[model samples]
Target: MTSIITHNDQELLKLIGERQNHQAFEVLYQRHFDAVFRYVFKVMQDRETAEDVVQNIFISLWKKPPSLNHPTLLPYLFGAARNQIAKEIRKNKWNKEQLDFIENTKGICSTDEYLEERDTRKLLESGIQKLPQKCRNVFKLSRFSYLSNKQISEKLGISVFTVENHIKKALYLLRQSIEFIVICLVSWY
Candidate 1:
C-alpha cells in the first residue's frame, strides 16, 4: 500500500471526502497546522484563542472537506484562517490594533501575494464608496487626508467619539468587502 504521506493535498482531500479516511485527515492537519496556527496566533495575540480558531478550522475541514480544483490546500487553509480570525475579532470586539494586525498580515500568504496591487486598490476604493456618506467622509479624512480623530471631529463638527465610531464602522465594512473579493480571487487562481 502507498503511504498517505506521499499523497498530495488533493488526493488526501479526496480520501477524506470519499472514504472518511482519518489518516489522510491527520496528514493534512499535520501539514498545515503550524502555518495556520502561527498565522492565527499572530493576529489573535492570544495562544489559547488562536489554538481554538485553528482547531475549529481543522475540525470544519475534517467534517466537510471542500471540493477544490487546485492541487494545493495552502490558499484555502490561509483563507479559512483569515476568515476565522476576522470572525473572532468581530465576535470579541477586539481593538483596532488587532484589526490593523490582520490587515497587515493579509499579504503574508502566497494567495494574497498574487493579487495585483491595482486590483486591490480598486476594490478598496469601491468598498469606500459603498460606505455611508458621513462614514465615508470620515474615513477618507482620517485615512487619505491623514487627519487625526480630533481633527476629523472638528472639521466634521462631530464629537471625537463619533469620528472614531465612523472610522471603525468604515474599516469593518471595508475589511468585509475586501475579504470577500480576496477570497473570490484566491479561489479563481
Candidate 2:
C-alpha cells in the first residue's frame, strides 16, 4: 500500500494522465477500495451487489484513467456510486412493474402510481410534525418508537381502543396531508 500524499490526490491522476502509470493506479485502488466498497454497501444492501458495483467502478477508472481536466477521482467515484444506486433502484422498480403488469391485466400501478406512492410516503414522513398531538404521539410510537399498541396503552395509561383509534387517526391524517401536498404540487406545476 502506498502512503497517500498529505495533500493532492491529483499526484496519481497526473501520473496516470502523463504516462500509463499502472503503479499509480494500483495505489489509487488500494486507497479507494475500502471507501468505494463501503459506499456501495451503504446503498445496495447486498454484499455481492456492492462488490460488483465496486468492480465496475474501478474498471471504469482504468478504462480511461485521467485527463488533463479530470476532476478529483474520489468525489467522482462516490458520485458514480450514487448514480449506480439510483439506477439499480429504478431498474428493480421497473422489473416489479413489469411483473405486476404481466400478472394483473385488470389493474396495475403505472409509472405515475409508483412516483405518486413514493412522493406520498415522503410527504407523510416529513409532515408528521404537523399531526395533532395525540395522533402524532401514537404515530411515533408505532412507527419510530417501535412500540406495540398494547405497549403504548400501558405506557400512556390509556384504553387499548383509544390507542388503536389514535393510530388509525394518525394514519388517516398522514394520508390526507400527503394528498394535500400532492394536490398543491400539481396545481403549482
Candidate 3:
C-alpha cells in the first residue's frame, strides 16, 4: 500500500473522492481527527456527544467529499463542526425552554421562594461584575462564551497559563463575595 502520509491533502482528497479509495479516506481521518475532535469537544463539552459529532463529520466527508483544496480543508472542517454545534445548542435550548414552561405552569415554587432565587442570582451577577477586568473577561469567555482555556488564550492573545490563572482568580473572588453575602443574610435571620 502506498503511504498516504507523504501525500498532500489535495492528492489524498482526490484519491478518496474521485477514486473511491477507502484507505485514502482513512488517512484523511487520521490526519484531522485530533484537531476536529478538540474543536468539537470545546463547544459540546460532553465527551460522548463530541465523539459522536466527530464521527458524523467524518462520515459526511466520506459520503460527499467537497472539492476542498489542501490549504482550505482544515477551515472547512472547523466551519462544519461549528455549524453542527450551533444546531445542537439550539435543539437543547428549545427542549429546555419547553420543560421550563411546563414546570412553571405547574406552579412548582411559591412567589417568595422565586423572589429569593432571583435575589441570589442577582447577587451572583454582581459578584462576577466585581472581578478585575482581565479576570472577568477570561471568566466570561470560559463560562458564557463556552470557550476552552486554549481557545480563550488564542482569542485574547494570552498564554494558556495566564488564562487559567485569570479564571481561578475570578472564581475565587466570586466565591468569597457570595460567602460574605450568605453570612450577612444568615446574621440578619
Candidate 4:
C-alpha cells in the first residue's frame, strides 16, 4: 500500500533481506545504480569492466542483502566496487592498450631499470594493501581513479577533509615503504 520510494535505505534493505522483496530491491538498485556505475567507471576506465563490476555489486545485494549498521548503503556499495576492482587488478588482466604500452617500453629502458621500476611498483602496491581500509579506499579513488576530493567525499559519504587526511596518510606510508627505491634512483641519476 505504500510507495517504495518513500522507504529509507535501511527499510528497503530490511524488506529485501527479510522478505526477498523484488520491488524493494529494484527501488534500491535504481536509487544507487548510476552513482555506483559512475564511480566504478572512473576507477576502471573501461566501460565493460565497469558495467560488470556494477552489475555484480547489485547482483550480490539482491542475492544476499548485507546487514548494515550505517544509515546509508552507498558506502557498502562503493566498498564492494573497490574490492572488485582490486581483484581485477590482481588478476593482471590489463587492457590491450596497457599491454601494448608495456611491450613498447621494453625497448626503451635498460633491463635493470625496468626490473627496478617493476619492483618499485610492487612495493607501492604492497604498501597500499597494508594501509588502513578507509585510507586505502580514499587513496585509490584519489590517485588511481583520478577523482576530485569533492567527488570522493560524495561517493564515500565522508567529508572532503576526511578524504584529504586519508590521502595524506596513504602517501606517507607509501613513501616510507618506497623510500629506498627513490634514493637508489636518485643516486643513479
Each candidate structure's TM-score, on Cα atoms with residue i matched to residue i, is: 0.56, 0.42, 0.48, 0.49
* Candidate 3, 89-135: lDDT as tens digits: 67776345434433343332344544575588689789988999999
The alpha-carbon lDDT assigned to residue 96 of candidate 3 equals 58
Give the C-alpha miss distance for residue 143 in model 1, angstroms. Answer: 34
The residue-by-residue lDDT of candidate 4 on 1-189, one tens digit each, is 889898978899999999999999999999888767876676667777888889988999989998877557776776787677666765867576644443343333334544565577678888899999999999999886768999999999999999999999999888887886678879999
Distance from true location, Cα of 42 in model 3, Å: 1.0
Stretches off by above 4 angstroms in model 2 are 1-7, 66-72, 94-189
The candidate that achieves the highest TM-score relative to the unseen native structure:
1
Name the candidate, 1 or 3, with the larger TM-score value: 1
- Best of the two (3, 4) by lDDT: 4
TM-score of 1: 0.56
- The lDDT values for all models are 0.86, 0.69, 0.76, 0.80
lDDT of 1: 0.86
Residues 31-82 of candidate 1 have per-residue lDDT tens digits of: 8787678677778878789889999999999999998776678778888998
After the best TM-score superposition of candidate 2, give how far the Cα of residue 86 lies from its true spot, in angstroms: 2.0
lDDT of 2 by residue, 1-189 (tens): 455443245777777667867877787888777766765665565668778878888787777765534434565676666666656666776345433333343232334544565576567778788888888888898775557899999999998899999888888887788778779989999
Query: Which runs of model 3 end up more than 4 angstroms from their true locations?
Result: 94-189
**TM-score order of candidates, top first:** 1, 4, 3, 2
lDDT of model 1, residue 24? 97
